[model samples]
Target: MRSPSIAAAASTAVLMTLASASRGQTTGGFSLDRFEPAPAGDAFFGVPSPAAPGHLAPRVHAMLDYAHRPIHSSGDSPIDLVSSQALLRLGASLALWDRLLLSLDAPLAVAQGGDDPGIPGVAFTELTAPELGDLRFGARLRVLGRDAGPLQLGIGGYLFAPTGTPAQYTGDEEPRGAFHASLGGRLGTARSSLGFLWSASGGVELGGGPNRPQQLTFGAAAGALLGGDLLQLGAEAYGAAPLGGDLLLSSTPVQREEAGLNAELLLGAKLRVLGGLTFGAAVGPGLTNAIGTPSVRAVGMIGWAPLPQPDSAERAPAVAAGDKDDDGIDDALDACPDVKGDPSPDPAMDGCPPADRDGDTVRDIDDACPTTPGARSADVTRSGCPDDRDGDGFHDGIDACLDVPGSSSDDPRKVGCPADADDDGIVDASDACPKVKGTASRDPKQNGCPDDPDGDGVRGAADACPNERGRPDPDPAQNGCPRFVRVHADEITTSKPVQFIVYGKTRAQTVAPISDDLLREVRDAIQQNPDIELVEVQGHTDDSGSEEYNLRLSQERAEAVLSWLVAAGVPREKLVARGYGFERPLGDNRVKTGRQKNRRVQFMIIKRKGAAVQR
Candidate 1:
């Protein structure tokens, strides 16, 4: 019986040749099954590698595995299944920026099963194939991993190298080393890997050994991570047919076929059980055959894929602040954050509704000039708006005749509001003839009417008598003036003023002074004269006292007559005063009674315009 070493080498050589012919064969636990659960940066779950810093994923991984191959063959052929293989892996995933990733897989193995025969159920009586007995290395470079619509695609290539025993058959021809390449991608939760491989298999000739020819094969694989990323379960099947079926040249032409069907069921879990140390396990059972051998494989892996770095990728893009439509527009202050707003000035009001200036109870939108601050009842345009229509600092509605401008008059028709026609500041309705200009007056009936009385040549409106011009005409009608006349003597309208006083004799030295009624009588007489503009008062005193004292006393007496005119609502400017000492007295100052009579006040009339009054 061959030693374990010989057995292992021989078994490995045979497996190697089969493995080469079916380069795309899927191994039980780790051969081209796409153990890379997900491409470094895919959005299978969310933002691929939410753990990768700037998509740079730095990881260290290791795997220990064991496989048992059981061989069987069709009639007329012999089979030897005797190989146990173990492999270890350690590598870093350099996620270069965002676009690419570089990976390396270094494997070390200790394989020892081979056929020396003499063992029960062993299919081979003699071992004659080259067996693999050395370390192997492989590298993967991912060229793309980006969002394409709803799919995340990854394109990459893988290479494998052999550093193991080559010759096992009597006339061995299988090469000791080999290389392979592959591509992969992932969409949603599904992942797929494909590869095309070429290699040399066969050895020297003893009884005409099979030719170790170059061959090409194609394969496809796919998988998915279930539960969370921590637990994954998948299945993959691969098959390959040689590009050229002429693997050997035999003397007789016997149809030779080279093809393989490999299928595996894998279960793995990444347990973050102890801090950063990840305890991962994978077990796979061959379903079809890997290079025509029924094999069972189990892989146990423990790794620390270091904590994902911060400053990873740029902050996942803030959800876009204040963005309503997910479009950024601060609603609190957004005019039209959702939809583009009017390009006009005030962004706030541009998007929002504007304020109305008029108290019209209408909003700016419906209100033409929203800022038109007008009165509530103002006459507005069709849009319920106003624009200083009359330009009178007033709005239209309450503004009587909206178009026609009017002063403070009472004629609502012709005068916008009501002009103080006659400029008297009194409307026609309130004025006797508001249309006819007249100054304001206090007399009820004559408030704004002209004070014209008689129908003589001179208008009673200003004539004193108004019908008569001469002095003391008792019957004014026959004296060129009408019997009844209109008079306006308001403080603001009296044109002229006059005053007069009469002296009376006291019987038996007892005299009654002139009363306010009498003084008013004298004033009325003077007022009736249109020629009187103002009145002057003179007083005389008896000379029975010192000249200075008598003079002062006389002045006091004259002032008494003037006071009556003023109290009658007569303008003081229309009256004047002076003292005529005893020198001007008509009554003799010799007797007491005579002196008292001489001490009296007299009045005279003055003429003035615009100030003229008629009776």
Candidate 2:
């Protein structure tokens, strides 16, 4: 058993809907009574500040609009013949925090009644439209749209104040006092809201008392921006159903429980039109009673919203791409771009493969043995390569005899290519007495020079007795009065000291030879001196042949002296013979007299250990 007032409320709802359909060509933005007036569809234009460093601020919106809701009814209809309506709406959005938004919607509605005889003077009366619809206050909590691209979403609750006609508005049921709970979401460039409303105190009385009904409304809109995201074109549709009651229409309480439908087409644009300011305009035709009998409603709206702050996160990726080493060269084309790399191989060649002179595996710039093939090494002076010469510890530049194996660390003087030991201007290879002092008189190719005649350490050119030995042998005018003495073995006795001289000659002009007379004279002198306890025989020559050959020749000449001494019955232990090949000299080597002076060897007795050394 349902209450009669509840039934009458249902019927009156049907009549209001039928009357709106009976009139055609009306347009307006959606209102709570007609459709699920969402958290203003335009509110989306002001999405929260991007998750960057700033805030979305306060926003204001104002809209002036009019809607004509025309009604047509049957003759027995309890509702008036018809009524037309006009509406104005204004609102604003204030950001409460990063996640919550507060909004207020105020509307002013004006109505003009249709001609009807059932109510007297209805056309002449001043109908003020019941103070229009009361202000709607709402709050939306942003749950998940910060990064959710164009599809913004939210949930909110709205309250409509009791400002619409209820007493005089017999045909208009559920026209005042509504509370709506809305669940809202959006797609790219589009928004939608669905709400369940509890209407209070607007339906007809039931069982001699007032009755109220609950309603459900779904609203949805989809739009596109014409130029960038700046200009927008959108269309919205809404459906609502009355649940608990109907309005009494005719005397029969015409069952008016019904559903209503409305739609609006909007044209809006988002413009920077200025700094940080976004302005939009919306003009559309709203359809009313559109579920079964759709009627067109007209609406015009203008709104201005603040633009969101720019996002800092969007700039991070660009900065990282410009630098590769973090040194600012974008690695793709960097050539030798590693500025902190090690020192270059060659200061002139840059840090690349060095130039190789020889076709060796080692680069020439780094190859110590640049002319010879060798291994790559880290010897920077040798262009980072290693070279071994003489098969010894020293490189070729320091090795005196590069061809021979020599030790730079050990016996350097003994191992290098040989040289003349004496000052006779001859290398040892060509000097007759290589180790002993000598002259440069004889042929330098073989034995360098002959021996000295007098044992006074002077050769024939400087000695008075050029053929004798063991005498003063000075200039006769200055220090001598004796002539040459031919001595027998008794005259030259062992009890007395005697002089021995040996000279060198050569058969070939280039091959110097030992002097036969000089050799015999020295042998005879030694045989007569038994008291000659100490004998020193030195061989001499001029530079000839190689230093090595000269040195051997001089050594052989000194040995000849020792052999002759032993044959003459002198003890071999009493004589010390040495070769000085072209080293010590008695005269200048450039002249024939000097050559003769360089060719002789002389012997002297050592009377004491400190005896003066004779040439």
Candidate 3:
């Protein structure tokens, strides 16, 4: 016979179960119908759902479940019973390590109600109750699948503590444990609008309690993600079957049989919000005729998994200490902490300027010539001076003549001085005749003088007859002289005069197209008449301007003609240059044609007899 207390407790449990169902609540315990929260959509119930290892952090979950059994038969009996149940549960889970997870949960039977028959051979079965349920703790370890892989596998176990009162139908009044293995995976497009996932699990429970039996539990679920996983819809099918146990009848004597198979088909939806918060709900109907299985069940849950915070020790040292410029130097040690720079011994300069690749004191930013080695100087213009390519004391930029060695003066004209413009080995500034090709000379005035083309003893510039062979003379005027002038006796018998046309307005104006033939003729005459002792070059011009000017002009023309003949291999000592004003004319001065003829130079010849000749 059963004790009154036990009978009353059973009756109370039945009433509570019915009330809980009416209130949309269900009790939690070692039951085939319990749900497990997991990363996959199928995790709504009946499986050790596989998850990518370390993909999620610790989380807390709250769930409410309601179950209704409008009709249920016990064993082979035809009698039926109606009941409602409600339960609220709180749970937490954490990834303890690489592929390991630990979780704990507690449930409260909040409401239940149903019709109840007194226990066999017992009375006073009416009751009232709201009580705590079992405490569940579990660990899950991933056996396969990395965080980013499509296939995942895991094995785990759960321990249930009988923490509920029997009167509430919230617990089995005995401890229980379960071991499970699960496989899960995602299909379709991950992180896309059409992504999907599926999960499946199987496990065995070691039953320990009066009338309880060892059981096999298996489940599978599939889901589609809408709105990028913000919303999920899924369905699950799960079942449990007893492996072995003694046949037992209900304490009320309504039926007698061994444990039967229990199964359900559930559809669920979850909405993820606030990045880490998830709200979910599910409903399903029983698929079997098991005594304890409800005809319809529904569940609602809210879960949160706050993002993990990095520990100080786990954070990078540079980031933790603050490298504002990301230069690997902390702000405290960086002179220009906010700007990128380099390491240096000087506190004020370290990290303060851009890199200097050649170890030059000048930073590359301010160094105009950065690559080649240089020096710092007070001249800002040459602060980053390039190497002197010519081995000159002055560096490149300041030195105008870069490729050749020169002076160091900054004066535009003097700087880079002593350059050999003609490359004659003589420096240009000291070169009297810089442009002409020449040679070094001991005489400063004649230094860099052009070659003596005629092989004359004197240098070119100082030689009076530079292009002709001649002997040196003490007199500057007769320095390079030919011996004598040969002339015809008839030419010396009279004063011979050469005529010319005056083109310039002044006597000193330059003349164009002087007759080389005429000059050569005069030179030949001088060479032919060797008996001529002396020659006089006289000037005469037409009266075109003032008498004074005309006289000067005539005299210049005479001197020019004399110089021309002397330069054309004539004897310099035997020649004289004279300029006569326009005082004598051979033609009418007032006539344009006559004035042209009169504007002329005349040469006079004298014999060794000292007699002057007139033409």
Candidate 4:
């Protein structure tokens, strides 16, 4: 099944091929095998692992490889494109120092067979004899990392020479080369039970001439060492495409695989029969019908590969590392870097082993009350102690409320003591008016419950003067009030200061007539409240005077006021006077303002409506 038009075109192509071959030249295309193998560790049949086992010393390598039908075609009837070919390759590699590797290989096509159509201009185009392929030499240099480490990088290139027969389709006519960047890494070690490595390369293949297209070449390989380092298995893929030129990763390489992926895949196994002597075989198929990509391929290889001795890093460290804790584990891996203890995985406790003496989860180092079991807390001081929010003697659990101090109670259920809702001494449990702050009372029923927050004994809301001390008054309008020494209130609530003029120096300081008006107001207020109980005229002085002089001076002032009240028809038996030498100051006596308030006479009502309410 051959069309005349296609056969004519094929004949023209053949004539051109013959014309080129006669001059000992080729179209510089269709050379199949691309060999670039790493010099050390494990290697695949074609593309190699980018690893060099050891580089301390120079290492030499040799290989003999045979491939079946690595370059062939199909379905071209009378003009039968070659169906099979046998190839033999001999190669060698040498690695220098820990960086550079050099290699060379020469291949021979032993036999190639295909059909020939009797078309004009193409009569002698069929292949029948053995031929030689191009000669290849290559070199690579380490760019980063230790050659054998898990992340080494390298860059290299291969040079091709026109050393084979042009008729066999195995060589490029013009000198050419390919350059690439390679990356990969190896894990474990040759001495270890297991070792693995991987490599990938990408670069450009130089074109020989106008007829030969420059291609983007790529390869990937992975290999492993097993059977205690005696056996190796690997797989690899290598390809080239002019259409994929340069942008291999950014472009749709996946689409190339679906459409025209020109690559061959190989899987092989190698075994070391003797020291440095490895024998291997591989088989695979081409992914697309590009030049040199065969329908099916098989390869066999025999080689001597020896690894170099590892460097000092593979041995014990030269110097002693710091270990302040004296733990067997190195400080680097220790959870508690400075603490002498076991290792831990947590960074907070790493190297420092977890320890809690009291069996609480809280670490002893951070626990405040180390001996006692406690809850976790933001406060380092009490982290390990029972929760005490308000700082009361009772634990938070027994305390009815948190963040509020409570009193100690006889009741077990109320161990937190008195849970005073208000800041008064009386516990809210006993205080009927819990919200009202008040003083303690002898009678529980009439205690803080009645809301005598001022404790002046004016129970309920009737006491116009709440906080200050007060007494029951005979005046209905101002009953249970404290403040203003006025007749309207019937009690000495407050008034202008009682001014006095003292004349007697040696004779018990006489009260002058200068404070007469102020004294009369006090007398009038007391007279208006006949039902009022005993009233105590308290005198006080600032700290400016000596204690003895202030007491004597204040006593005279209080007695002066008291005598005025008794003279104004007030019962003398119902009144008493006392002088306190700056002892119960209503304000700080250090300042002039406070001293002014201190040097004053106070009419204190020793009176209360509630029998239990006390000053």
Backbone atom clashes (below 3 Å) for every candidate? 44, 92, 32, 17
lDDT of 4 by residue, 54-139 (tens): 45433333444343443332333434345566766677667666577777777787777654434444334556556888888888
Q: TM per model?
A: 0.34, 0.37, 0.45, 0.44
Residue 609, candidate 1: alpha-carbon lDDT: 62
What local distance difference test score does each model get?
Answer: 0.41, 0.43, 0.61, 0.61
Q: Per-residue lDDT tens digits of candidate 3, residues 222-296?
A: 888775567778998887778966323333332234466777888988887787688888898987656457788
Query: What is the per-residue lDDT of model 2 for residues 185-232, given as tens digits with 9 covering 90 to 100?
Result: 323321111111111111111121122335554544445443333454
Q: Which ten residues in a row have the lowest lDDT in candidate 1?
A: 199-208
User: What lDDT score is found at residue 310 in candidate 3?
Assistant: 29
User: How much does candidate 4 score in TM-score?
Assistant: 0.44
